[model samples]
Target chain A: MALKAPLAYETKHHLSYYECDATGHPSLSMLISMAVQVSEEHGNSLGLDTAAIQSYGGGWVITSYEGSFAAQQPINGEEVILGTRAIANNRFFALREFWIQSADRQVEYVRLTGLFVYMNLQTRHLMSIPQAVIEPYHGPEKKRLPRLAKARELKDVRFKNDYHVRFFDIDSNRHVNNARYFDWMQDPLGAEFLTHHQLKHMTMRYEKEVRYGQTVTSEISSPYRNENGELTTDHRIVVDGQLAAASTMIWYE
Target chain B: MALKAPLAYETKHHLSYYECDATGHPSLSMLISMAVQVSEEHGNSLGLDTAAIQSYGGGWVITSYEGSFAAQQPINGEEVILGTRAIANNRFFALREFWIQSADRQVEYVRLTGLFVYMNLQTRHLMSIPQAVIEPYHGPEKKRLPRLAKARELKDVRFKNDYHVRFFDIDSNRHVNNARYFDWMQDPLGAEFLTHHQLKHMTMRYEKEVRYGQTVTSEISSPYRNENGELTTDHRIVVDGQLAAASTMIWYE
Candidate 1:
């Protein structure tokens, strides 16, 4: 029997100065980390913690993310709300929604959704979602999950940077942290572009896990206008000529 | 007249998994960051915020840090208490003490002290501490502040690694974060040593600030036993053959 729980969970967080960038806004990586943290709390509230999930011989792995950011981003030292909800899931896939908002609910800073899959811990192979793990969340069962925006393949690479994954990059899961990919994906845009533009929307897909002691090349296409006339940039992370992850970002002045 | 404020300030923090290392303990860098956050809160509580201090044409800058850690450390998802108090200050130098302990106050995780000096934001030279800033803390005024352990000069360097400062490394202060030095100082030791050993004590001194787009060379001496029969390692961060920062760490199995 599933333990009854709230369909959604929310928590308050105080943004620290170290979490913000030079522009005084929360860095994208930190924002994503906050989202992940909230989701972990949500799961723990439902009594489905890492130990419980891994006991079924698998652990949740994020495959892709799609999100949008508002122009008025949260600043350092501000108290904000982090919320997450399980949207829908199937045997092989699960979808979750997340948001970051002002404490008074006056402003919406970020809205994101992630696609997840269960992976066997020892065999490193995809596994079906465990009944005990997914039951408590009470997400609707779906035969097919909604498709997220796929990262367009990188073409006409205009800039490239090589980053050697350091020991600190690996988190408790023993692989490079999922949120860290944002730093590598956008850093090659250089300080000038990063400072002048604000990220409005982003879509990222992870095809391979980056490990410690690996040098990954971050490649990006020059900023161009989309059909909606929004400035867009395409990014891809490659390791040893193999695509590790790819992302597309829409920016505004 | 100074505003009446508590001589010490304390706050509770929930340690996120991302802040911990693969060993399931808070990383040295994150522990230092937590201490810094608590001090900032302490200053803010006394109405000595950055703006208030910077109005005098300078800001507080850390010159050195010395600290010790307990055998039992806090783990991810644990709620811990962070506390800070002004120890003593002079016209040009100030010293602050910090600690991290269990919520129930049964176990002490870390105890640290930092030496600080006011620096002119424009001239980047030492400046006398402003009365408005120091008076509110109610710390005893002194003619000479206690000195912290100085980092030993690196000798017989056995291992070295190069790290490129990324855009994310620069915080709101616009320089590499003070906590980041710990990562650079210790990463060259490799994962095997880091996982098998725990940091028992550390002393670090900052000589120069690292900026964005700079590649730093982190060099370290082989671990050796000190006179107290404790394993100790010496580390230095160099940029262009110039010493930027240095540290000494004592570890226990």
Candidate 2:
């Protein structure tokens, strides 16, 4: 019989006060932090250490991500399980999936899918993944990495505003939280907008993940302003054309 | 001139959700995790590492700490400073002070004093300080460390009955926020007790500091129920024989 490939590794985490938002639930940034930790662990389990990857002249860089949060989040004292798996890998990219499940396993509070690029650390550019790095995972080569949905420029959109990444936005991973991109993507709209309009639908696709120690520009496109009075805006989270994430938010009256 | 004692070192940190509290400030427990990292740096300055301490059949453990908070706490994007000093050491114990400062030097959000003891890791019992550990700090010996004020056990305090550490109470340090003790210390009577009952007289003295991964037991003495009808309580935060902290709340209606 052919050997079986493990789906993923699991880690347990406890909720901390720092992870919560104004609503008392874990903040969008914290949800991303948990996802990154699980991803790192997934890489380590495959025998890919920082030095090992560096030695290959490339490092893993998150290219894009999509996460969906369902129901209310975990609160303080809750024991959460974070799990990740290697879905597929290619010469230049890899795809991974992560989840945060409740102890009872009855509910999945969060689900995330991310694409990462193998990059040359020195040149600060994308590079091909080495077979040495790819062969160990045993994922299929035929898998396709999805293309991010195009975002209309803010000038073309109805809402436009700017925000600077604050100190707290940076995590131990030294990167902006994946979920926070949603905030920056939407902050330009006023609270009046958020209150009167709820996010009826959203599709965020990442082209790059912003890292710590760097500043980027976030631009939003005009809302499509649908007939039912619902509004939809398209956004591009960018660090100078390394498109970080492209998203669309549909708000309802 | 002897260099003003190499006082700090660098450490990488992983941001965890529990570290931030309800106000979105990095809680006391998170501060301690960074403090522990700084403490490890202080030991490294003395040529001590985990293996070195273990080789001697004992390890350093913190017994107590006293911390003062400034007006504002650390929020998300800022890079914080971690520092420690072996202020004094005696045959039995050592007193170390650790701090988490803002990057711009604009704030010293947390000022902490820790009491440490050398103990046999296997037995989990206190042992005398080794000459090897004490000789490096180069400080005069004192019979007793500076004392912390004790919370008066009062008989007239009211119990509010609404204080509990939630799951988010746990931080990266794996403990509840020490400042939280103040909440438990103050909450029993609730804010109403504060407004109606004149705190004409109140005091809190911390004897020991709490740490991560430990459960703290708190109890308050019955209010004496004076003629004024104001409630008062004597609060004690304890673990085993160790007195963690003490406070006395008084109300004058």
Worst 10 residues of 2 chain B by lDDT: B160-169
- lDDT tens string, model 2, B137-178? 665567877864344554433342322233334343334544
lDDT of 1 by residue, A25-106 (tens): 9999999999999999998998988888888999999999999999999987899999999889999999999999999999
- For model 1 the TM-score comes to 0.97
Give model 2's TM-score versus the native structure. Answer: 0.48
Candidate 2, superposed: residue stretches over 4 Å from native: A1-3, A143-161, A165-183, A189-202, A205-217, A221-232, A238-244, A250-253, B1-253
lDDT score for residue B65 of model 1: 98
Model 1 error, position B251 (Å):
0.2
lDDT of 1 by residue, B1-253 (tens): 8745438989999999789888888999999999999988888888878888889899999999999999999988899999998888988898999999999999999999999989996678999888888887778887888888877777879889998898898887776788998999888888888889999999999988888999999999988888899999999999988989999999986
Local accuracy of candidate 2 as per-residue lDDT tens digits, A32-151: 778877766666678875567778897777766666666556864477899887777767888878888998888888887777788886687888888877666666664576653344
lDDT of model number 2:
0.61
Flag clash pairs in model 1: none
* TM-score of every prediction relative to native: 0.97, 0.48
Q: What's the distance in Å from true for residue A37, model 2?
A: 0.6
Sorted into a CAPRI-style docking class, model 2 comes out as incorrect
Model 1, stretches more than 4 Å misplaced? A1-6, B1-6
Contacts from the true interface found in each model, as a fraction, amount to 0.67, 0.02
